[model samples]
Target: MKKITNAFRLTLSLILIAVVFSGCLIREVEQPATVKTGGEFQVKLTITDKTADANAHYGAVCVLAPDDWEFVSGSYDSQVGTGIFLFDSSAKPVYGNIDSVLAPPAGMKWIKLLSDAAFTNPADVIHEATINLKVGQKTGDYNIGYFTTKNSADLLGSLNMSDEDNDNAWSDTSMNHKVTVELAVGVEDEKVVPTKFSLDQNYPNPFNPETTIRYSLPVSGYTTLKVYDILGKEIAVLVNGSKQAGQHSVQFSANNLQLTSGIYFYELRVGDSSASDKSEFSEFKETKKMILTK
Candidate 1:
């Protein structure tokens, strides 16, 4: 009976080995552990395995973003996949069989999300989205996750039940497919600010190829900083966007515009963005003179 016992022990060991090897096929999404709200930040979506694996092809990916955050823009370096994003107030929370045809049905607001195009190498796919805190957004922790629609075997049409060949690697298929991130909102309130809007004179006035212009805003608003020649003709737009209430600076490069040595004026215009005091700062504009030698 000793020979029989040895054979049984060997068989049991082989079964345990097969079970352990078959458990690590799927992968989870990784991202930063924390992000600051109010300020713009990037949400990166990447797989654990960094190597460009040959079998990592995915047909579709769906990402569910936090409801309170505002969608800014997608990362400029999105890999070979087209994306569709939505942010509708009338949208409702929709979660279910992500692979189902009706998962992301029409009109789902409050959820800023992205649906990716098919035919992508999972390992090579690195996605990023820029987001910021919605006006008056509360600070807290949030989770962001994605679900893949098609696995490697499902893409290549080699679906099988058992891992006899161990060819599949779609390991992470949990329901809560997300990573947690802490968001600290309203942190800007404690920061200092100027009492009023002001624009300072550019340094190195007679600059060779570049000069710097400094300006400050007392409150959050849309700002426009433009460079104009002595004749009031616009030379270049240095800054044109919404900015927080703080001191800001931008550089002027005369090398690209082929601007000759001459006197130029820079102007700063501020427009109210808050609905409560929309007309309070309608007439905020400042101008400063600068000279460029070469």
Candidate 2:
């Protein structure tokens, strides 16, 4: 009888060890290596079970986002849950009995993704969760935070973790993900502006009912384009308005003007205009001559 009891006790101990070992799991995050400012990108999370338990499952995942980024939507797993919770810079979670979406703490900004059902299928290599995000206008390397949970509760003490330490929390493991951003194509740097002002001669000069006038402004100010006869008489005001510091063009049609074919001069002027007064750039004037024929 003593021998039988010893054998039974040993068997029970081994069974408990197997159960504990089967619950070991780790999270891996995959995301785009780089993205452009204001562009949308995808982040993928793969959860791997070291224990290979068919019954192991997770209900939620909490992620920390970089500054200037916002949560878009996330991929939904019907096998897991029906809906997900969206959080920004300010979020607080309830530690217990998280059935639905829980708001983050006041002044705490975080992003929590939830599933109604639960992620399972340990037989598969991994379970996946994908989230969409929008990149902000800043350019630099950004880090993302990852954590696992059973329900809406604090699964990995993520709520208590600070944003500064969140990215480094998983650095020891291979679960860290960094996203790189650059300025979008064709988007000029905010610090750059025009440096010199100049005007180009009209094209198709010397003979035509219509001509094109081009000019450049070194600074943002009021500008005007006037057409005058060779005798110094103002024939028409082609352009009179505020213009940004850049190259601009205006097309002039002589079809409506009641003038015979002759040589004409076009002038460009720039100045600072006040709200109470319509100023002119007359002090800074440039002229180019063109000819028109019937």
Each model's lDDT comes to 0.43, 0.49
How many pairs of residues collide in each model?
9, 16
Q: Write the per-residue lDDT of candidate 1 for residues 44-68, one digit (tens) a residue.
A: 3332322344433323233344444
Shift in Å, residue 252, candidate 2 = 46
- Cα-based lDDT at residue 168, candidate 1: 49
Best by TM-score: 2
lDDT of 1 at 9: 10
Error of 2 at 56 (Å): 11
Q: What TM-score, computed on C-alpha atoms, does each candidate reach? A: 0.34, 0.38
Clashes of 2: 16
